[model samples]
Target: MLRARVELRELARDWRSWCKAIAEAAEKTLGSSRVYVFGSAAEGYATGGSDVDVLVVAGRLPRSFRLRGEIKARIEEEAGLPLYHPFEIHLATWKEAEANPIYREAIEKGKIINAQGLDSMKPIGESFGESRGRLPDRSLGQR
Candidate 1:
């Protein structure tokens, strides 16, 4: 349990650093997009071993997939944590996110580290709760 506490602290610190790093890297590489923190981290469910999840919303996908890979690899190396398994890179226009219910939900929960593409990131409508059918009720209180 003591070890778990230490790990949790480390994970929290790393999450902050990784989010900052990703925002900086995205600014340098993508130039005209927004970077957001999502998933467990955004929802305040992150634990000691949680992976840092993010969404890079852009008008267009990066021209260099290699660049994207490099950015992700560097984040992993720097954070000393494997990225959230099957890390997502949702490439879509702002309009696309506005139209998609799922994407809108993510954006609603997401915290914007950098808002370059637009002045600020806005939630389209009310954010939805995680589906009750998916997560066990007991786990919600465990954290």
Candidate 2:
């Protein structure tokens, strides 16, 4: 039991390190783009099987570059762990990202680890009720 627990802890640490390394690698290779960690990891709800989701918004990659695949390979090789699975890479120009409502919404909710072009990488924790109008209390028997 103790051995199993130790192995699990090591695995968790390795997964986190891989995620960080992947983020760093993307930052180094991509250049001047906003990199975010979204989905389960971003929301602090990740378990043993969450793939690292990175959103890259900047100038488009060159035609010769397979950015997502390259990043995945590099991370796999560097980390020596098969922690990353079929990850999601949403690429867009900065202008395009700003114009898209979904992007805005993600930015408003997602965790920005390395917000290059953006001002800050802090998480936007504003409640929907606070941002807009008050929401009816569903549990209070009033709507």
The TM-scores, one per candidate, come to 0.53, 0.52
User: What lDDT would candidate 2 get against the real structure?
Assistant: 0.53
Off by over 4 Å in 1: 1-13, 62-90, 115-143
**On residues 106-138, what C-alpha lDDT tens digit does candidate 2 reach at each position?**
555675554132333456444223342222233
What root-mean-square deviation over C-alphas does model 1 reach?
Answer: 11.1
**Segments in model 2 whose C-alpha atoms lie over 4 Å from true places:** 1-16, 63-87, 99-102, 115-121, 124-143
Candidate 1 weakest ten by summed lDDT? 134-143
TM-score, structure 2 vs. true: 0.52
Weakest lDDT window of 10 consecutive positions for candidate 2: 127-136
Residue 138 shift from truth in candidate 1, angstroms: 41
The lDDT values for all models are 0.54, 0.53
